[model samples]
Target: MYTLILVLGICAAALFLAGFARGLRNAVIEYRRGKPEPTEVPDYNYVGMAAISVVISATVIALVGVAPMWIYAGPLMVLGTAAGIGVAFFVERPSA
Candidate 1:
């Protein structure tokens, strides 16, 4: 019973992740097509970005742990995937 539910949850998460990856790839391709290749390396705070990601992951885990898996897994995964796909579109190229 519990084992079956866990398996289903894992499968659903995998499918959502695959969709997100596909959307991300398409978004990157579209973005590149609209912009020229950069002449200079972009400055980014890699450590800060990683730390923020870790904090968000930890917060999500804590919130999800409070709910029954069956109640939270489906909607949260769907919403998360949708949000990720939507955000991919915001990487706009500057107008000419």
Candidate 2:
């Protein structure tokens, strides 16, 4: 179970990185082409939540002592996945 979670997390992280890099490259290209700038900056509520989730998960692991990986891994993985989803929502949110 722990190994499965680890692999899933790694795969998700890699996919996120690849997508982020591609989006950033495209944004730069568009900016260089003189596209109009966004009218408003986005709020970072999701990002903040994601950060908080990670911090909470880390605190849990630290307190629990992960020498028992099976016991600790479930909650940590759930929190981590929630964080990732929060980030995805953050990126996809409309500027306001």
Candidate 3:
């Protein structure tokens, strides 16, 4: 069970990296085509991102079980909450 969770976590991380790469490629292509500079970060669909993150964390915690929960849950929740807020701030902030 733990091994499965680890593998899933790795897969999730890989997918996230691939997505970031794809977004970077798209932005580069747009820039190369002389498109008007994007005035914003683009709509990130935070609901989708949040859902995935929650699922990943939940899966991890379920696999890790209760003993480590005390150690992991607090930090994960705090950091995840902070990251969510940070993303929102960036998304909402006007582009300079």
Q: Compare the candidates by TM-score and give the number of the best one.
A: 2
Q: What's model 3's TM-score?
A: 0.39
Candidate 2 segments exceeding 4 Å error: 40-96
Q: Which should have the higher TM-score, number 1 or number 2?
A: 2
Superior candidate under lDDT, 2 versus 3: 2
Ranking by TM-score: 2, 1, 3
lDDT of every model, 2 decimals: 0.62, 0.65, 0.58
Residue 82 alpha-carbon offset, candidate 3, angstroms? 14
Q: After superposition, how far is residue 75 of candidate 1 from its true place, in Å?
A: 4.1
2-94 per-residue lDDT for model 1 (tens digits): 576567657666656676666677667767788655677678779988999788767767877687664555455555655555454444443
- Where does the lowest 10-residue lDDT sum fall in candidate 2? 87-96
How many residue pairs clash per model? Answer: 0, 0, 0
lDDT of 2: 0.65
Q: Name every residue pair that clashes in candidate 2.
A: none
Global local distance difference test of model 3: 0.58
Winner of 1 and 3 under TM-score: 1
Error of 3 at 49 (Å): 13
Q: How do all the candidates rank in terms of lDDT, highest first?
A: 2, 1, 3
For all predicted structures, in order, the TM-scores are 0.41, 0.43, 0.39
In candidate 2, what are the lDDT values of residues 11-62, reduced to their tens digit?
7677667657666776667767885767776666698889998897677668
